[model samples]
Target: MNSLKRIMVGLDLSEMDETLIRYTAFLCSISEIERVYFIHAEKSLDIPDEVLESMPNGMPADEKLRASLIEKVESYFGPDSRVQVDVQVVEGSPLKELLHWSKVKQIDLILAGRKFHMRGSGVLAQKLLRTGRVSVLFVPENIEPRLNHIVVSVDFSEYSLMALDRILDSALTRPEVRITCMHAYEVPTGYITLGISYEDFDERMKGFARNKFAQVLERFPELNDRATLHLVKQENEDDIGELVMVEAKRLKADMLVIGAKGKSAAALFVLGSVTEKILRYNDDVPMIVYKKENEEIGFLDALLGND
Candidate 1:
């Protein structure tokens, strides 16, 4: 579990983007966040002819836009602030610029606002999860910046283990935090398609789930004393994503954490089907999508090879 020291927030100058900045401010008040960077990436370096003509001779359009965006971001924090704030305006696609900044600044966490209904924004969000290395926090509209109850989606994979580690690390620092480790299992569709007994099939799946849960408890003994485990069984007719959301709501979870496996040749980027689907339907709950540390090695590791 790594505590965030530096955070890079994506700023799109939208209403939801303000929510992200406000959420970051809340973290600064509660945690040990030392620095914040609000970055906006402009797609083109070239300014519109109308705007360029209005500016004084020899004045660069990019510089002027950067100054304006910085001022707008600064107003969110006001004059007095404990955390150091930096405003950046870069020219390129949002995904590329944000990814490069995260690596260069060694950002521990990346924050951005999300509205699932917006297709363009949704695409950019997926790009961040797929391509970016830093852990991402997608804050929905009207999210409280509080983590009273957290639901962590697990599947016993190393990616889920990484998510569990980060969630537990944060939970340890906060007393009386309610943590639920949720594992959703599904029955094979072939059983239902072939008209097999639903009850018998369900029972067999439950037996396997029980054994898996036991193994999970053994791997994370801390949960025995600190957290509760929730087992979910999904039949062929049930949507895994909907089931996850329902369980989280039943527990009244304030946040959800899940792991993302980085890009592979076949899939490009893998956060698993369930995790991505949950992201699609999510509206208000703040979700943290953490990537495995060793999955995509940096330049140094690539150079070193298997030593």
Candidate 2:
């Protein structure tokens, strides 16, 4: 009876496919996720008209290839599985197809693998992170499963509040899951008076931020028993992305969660830079970018097509 009824996992048909399936199965087992969708995207072949005319009206090799991939996915994740599973193969862009499928089917979560190399820009991943309605779980390869340390970055924004609530409501709230709520603040340059004696503005700001954290904690009583707070000071004038990276390393956190935003007024149409930078640069740790909306721009929209 878990609320996350449908879970979608994007498959690349790579060596890590099995691991992705195993992780998805593990999640479904824990959350009682009712449906699991396995999606793979393929490009349509450019065969000459003469070649098509010569072929008989029978199953093509591409179809067989798609079938084999689906079978492999189902065999690994669907065997003796209580959760209902469906395999889908679609033509066109991978990210776009995945988002379209998610929206059309109303998926509750999207599970995707994180690449270590800069094979291609993660436009689809970024889009899904920013505007997708469901929660996203980005799993890094070779990460040993452990819930020992969980880091949730808070900006005191409504989006961060929603992300924190979702984490607590999900598997993260378990007694064994060690949770750290982090907030990083940067000191303004003018705060230091040149003529007068050094003011205690930094101390006052820290106290104010602590009070804000306290207010958020009061709104969620469930976290009181399972969560611990950590306040960070960013004296280097780095952005939120840098702050999160520093905090993740300092805490040796197993998972990082952040809220996504749009970039510019017009380009600000999708997920913001913080989430994208983490996904691109930080491959050592797995990150989850939670979204408030159901609609998301696909990978192809951002990378393949020009604006």
Best by TM-score: 2
lDDT of 1 by residue, 72-176 (tens): 667667778878999877888787788778877888788877775542454666677766567898888677677677888988788898788776664223656
Model 1 per-residue lDDT at 117: 51
Question: What TM-score would candidate 1 get against the native?
Answer: 0.80
lDDT of each: 0.75, 0.69
In the range 54-156, model 2's lDDT, one tens digit per residue, is 3344546445545666677676565677888888767867766786787778887788877664344445555566544567888776566656678988888
User: Once model 2 is optimally superposed onto the true structure by TM-score, how far is the C-alpha of residue 295 displaced, in angstroms?
Assistant: 6.9
Alpha carbon lDDT of residue 1, candidate 1? Answer: 39
Alpha-carbon TM-score of each model against the true structure: 0.80, 0.81
Candidate 1, which segments miss by more than 4 Å at Cα? 49-60, 75-80, 117-120, 171-173, 188-222, 269-272, 297-307
What's the true lDDT of residue 233 in model 2?
80
